[model samples]
Target chain A: MMDDIKELIEEGKFYFLNQKYNEALQYLNKALEKDPANIEVLYTIGIIYESINNPDKALEYFKKVIKIDPQHEDAIIHIHSISENQ
Target chain B: MERFVVIGLGRFGQSVAINLAKLNKNVIAIDKDPQKVEEIADFVFQAAACDATDEKNLRDLGLKNADVGVVSVGEDISSSILITLTLKEMGVKKIISKALSQVQGKVLIKVGADRVIYPERDMGERLAKRLSSPQLFDLIELTESHGILELLAPESFVGKRLDQLELRKKYDVTVIAVKRNVPKLKDDGSTSFKESMILSPGPDFEILLGDIMIILGKSKGLDKIKKVK
Candidate 1:
């Protein structure tokens, strides 16, 4: 199951790098379902949402990451920036 | 290139001179105060300490050949009027003057000023508008009842295609452009963002969160959009 989740994450990152946001979201959502507490998956999804101008969804994901791990530096910074702009 | 002569090196005059020079326009700034003239010497094509009210001094400076004249003697109504008359008599085609009040503005206009601006009052109005409507980013009045404005896309607009919104039929406003921050993938596999503008987006375009929409419409329609949550 761990190896499968890793593969899904890899596919998601590949699509994300190619700017195929919908395809990236599909793979990332699958990985998220398999491991709901995965910090990397959650953070990447947050970034995808933010890049697509969906601050509300991005904030949701970032906040979830922060709730799971308060020490998440990138997520914390993203939250502050999004809040400031809004 | 059009030559601009700006008289009086007050705050308003200095800003006008500096901005004109920045735009690659030929600007000659003149002021009675030598210190003010020295301060803006580097920014403009020419900076001279001379009494603009004296027709002889203005003629000596070759101001008669200037395409435009800006008389920005802030708060000194007499100086503004004098300079406006002098510039008009100098055969400057266009004269713009700064006035402290409507009465002064009227006098300047009668004294041959082509345009009179009240910067302080206009600035105060802009601040009040921004404070009242936080969603509005910027606004430019195209006419008395029409305006072009940049505003944050409202919550209800997210994820909906432009055709579905029917903004023209409903709000009577047109979205002329959309400004967005697009995400970019770096070589090192990190994500960054860059600002992009889509002018006259098609009907299939979808509204995204955090997008700033530049819309043009009548004031009534704009006010309605501003109230959107």
Candidate 2:
């Protein structure tokens, strides 16, 4: 199952790069189910959520990513952006 | 009431004169050099050679009667400040002075200049920025923290629609408009259609290939939004 989740994460990133946002979200979700604490996957999920106009969800994911990796530059930047803007 | 005077012909001076002229404002472009006045003759109602620091000549030009005045004496800091003070003494309604330094800026303001512009310093900063970030295309300052920008679409937003991207809600920005090159036909011979046209620009617009977008937002929000990609 862990092996499947890893494959799903790779597929999700590929879909994201291709701009297939919906397809990317499905794969990301599958990865999350297997390893819910995966910070990288959570950051990717935040990207998807922001892309889909879900600021609240995006902020939640970014917060989680920062909690796991406080020094994550992207998360720190986005958290400030989300809080200030929203 | 419509007439205005610009007393310098440097880059900053010329840009101001041209902008005012392009807006159909009645501008009088004056410079000490004959060549400077001649070059911008077409861009203004009148162009003449005049030393702006000369108080007598400023009064002769009816500085009090003119609606606005801009002192663009860019080369000589002393001359610019003296001209600004002279214009204020002439009781010009709006005296916009160009400053070469912070001290100059403060001096002009103290001399009763309605507004002070740091054109050289500002442009130097902008040029430095232009050299550093090749990815960043253009910037328009709305406030200290907020700005509008026309950036090359980021790698992350390549195929997303505005509604889907939800950038404004997430990042405090709105995509005001997009410029895309569609097949444009020239010299339409058909009477039915006199002009070539852009296609599929729906009211609910979708992002298309090679489209450059105009975005409005707080600068910090924009920086964050750019980072996610």
Candidate 3:
């Protein structure tokens, strides 16, 4: 199960680099389903949402990252931005 | 000399022409009302009273070669777009039309306005920010995320050099420039001064009395910067 998720994550990275946001999102979601605690997967989900102008959902994921890792500096700033813009 | 032909003579039109004129640019002020035309005569290179929606009148006034033609007749959306289309078709290089609503603005852009202005709405948004913020006085919103604004420095910066503040790390902002509203010392043997500005200032500068600084930051970053104050 872990091996499958790893291969999917690598494929997601390739799609993200190629600007295939939907494909990247598909694999990212699969990785999250396998290991929901993965910080990089959660952060990537937030970035994908933000790229499409969905700040509320992005904020949600960023908050989750903060809950899992309190010292996450980017999560702190991203939350600050989302709140201020709102 | 490039010329700006501002049509309508309404508040927005007048403001744009006056600001540009203050910048020492050539302005051709126009209005359908003779009184408005007379009011701005001295400030403009030329002032005239003419119906801007009328293509023949605009052509006769040599507005086609104008560097910009702003149609500010938002009271009547149809007239605004008509003037914009006329200006575009008449070979005016740039066309800015004022619109009362988003729908009106879209129509003007579709009809060939290079840009659109919403005076009442834009002012309302600006004033709303001022009303909500305890510290922010004026803002120039560049995007949803970015803005350059005039703000009072937080107490933390009362007597410190700008470099020490480290706004980028502390608050995620960049202080592009500092403005100190110090009084200018006149050519007198006595000690007296008049309120003035120093612009594009540097890190060596220290914040002082009556200073209204210009700051740049993300929208959220500014809130943190101000909140710390």
Candidate 4:
């Protein structure tokens, strides 16, 4: 099960780095379904939402990451920036 | 070679003084705080710490010969009004004052201010417009009735030729330019987005997704185009 999750995460990261946001999202979502408590997957999905100009969705995911790990520096910063712009 | 007097050393006043001086105009910057005056002394023609509301102090600064006076002390309406009045009485050709509210703006205009500016209100309006229409990049008012605007091409315009749309005849606006981001590879084989512009594209040019259209025409015409699906 862990190997499957790792493979899905690697594929998602590859698509994201290549700017194929939709494919990256599909893989990331599949990985999240397999391992619902993955903090990295949640943060990466938030970044994808932000890049696609959906700040509200981005903030929703970032807030969830903060709830799970209060010391998540990147998520905290993203939430603050998204809130300031809105 | 006209002289400009900026009465206030706040952010707005300092910016006005520095920009005027950069344009090779003679600028006199004044403020009640010595530190503020000293901070900008090197950049302006002259910097003085004096009470701007007092007509005697203005006269002592040789402001009577100034061609323009900008009063940015909007914190106190009384002082802003008094400084504007003193500048008007001093034979300054133009007096521009900052007003905190619409009522204060009216009062300033009534007291011989040639122009009254509301920095905060104007910024708020621009921010609201940009937030409401994410596609609108910029809007510049050229005159009371005309404006130049840059906005992302609406989805309907994609895959259509410019002439086929007959934008000028139908919407009464001219497409001055179109900007697009094309994918390019760098020397290191890294892919990047390169911005390209087609100035005054002819009839055969096809609109593409992610194109930014810069249009120039009456504000009403632009508003009409914006309403198109």
Q: Give the runs in model 4 whose Cα sits over 4 Å from its true position.
A: A1-86, B137-148, B159-172, B179-197, B206-209, B217-221
In model 3, the clashing pairs are none
Residue B29 shift from truth in candidate 1, angstroms: 0.8
Query: Per-residue lDDT for B139-200 in model 1, tens only?
Result: 88999999998988898997889999999999899999999877666676655567899999
Q: How close is candidate 2 to the true structure, as a TM-score?
A: 0.59
Best-fitting candidate, measured by DockQ? 1
Comparing 1 and 2 by TM-score, which wins?
1
> What's the ranking of the predictions by lDDT, best on top?
1, 4, 3, 2
Which residue window of length 10 is worst by lDDT in model 4 chain A? A47-56
| Selected candidate, larger TM-score, 2 vs 4 | 4
The CA-based lDDT of model 3 is what?
0.76
TM-score of every prediction relative to native: 0.66, 0.59, 0.59, 0.65
lDDT by residue for model 4 (A1-86), tens: 88998888778877766656678789989999998888878887887766544567889889989999999887898899878766
Count clashing residue pairs per candidate: 0, 0, 0, 0
Give stretches of model 2 more than 4 Å off. A1-86, B138-149, B163-174, B183-205, B216-221
Between the candidate structures 2 and 4, which one is better when assessed by DockQ? 4
TM-score of chain B of each: 0.84, 0.77, 0.77, 0.79
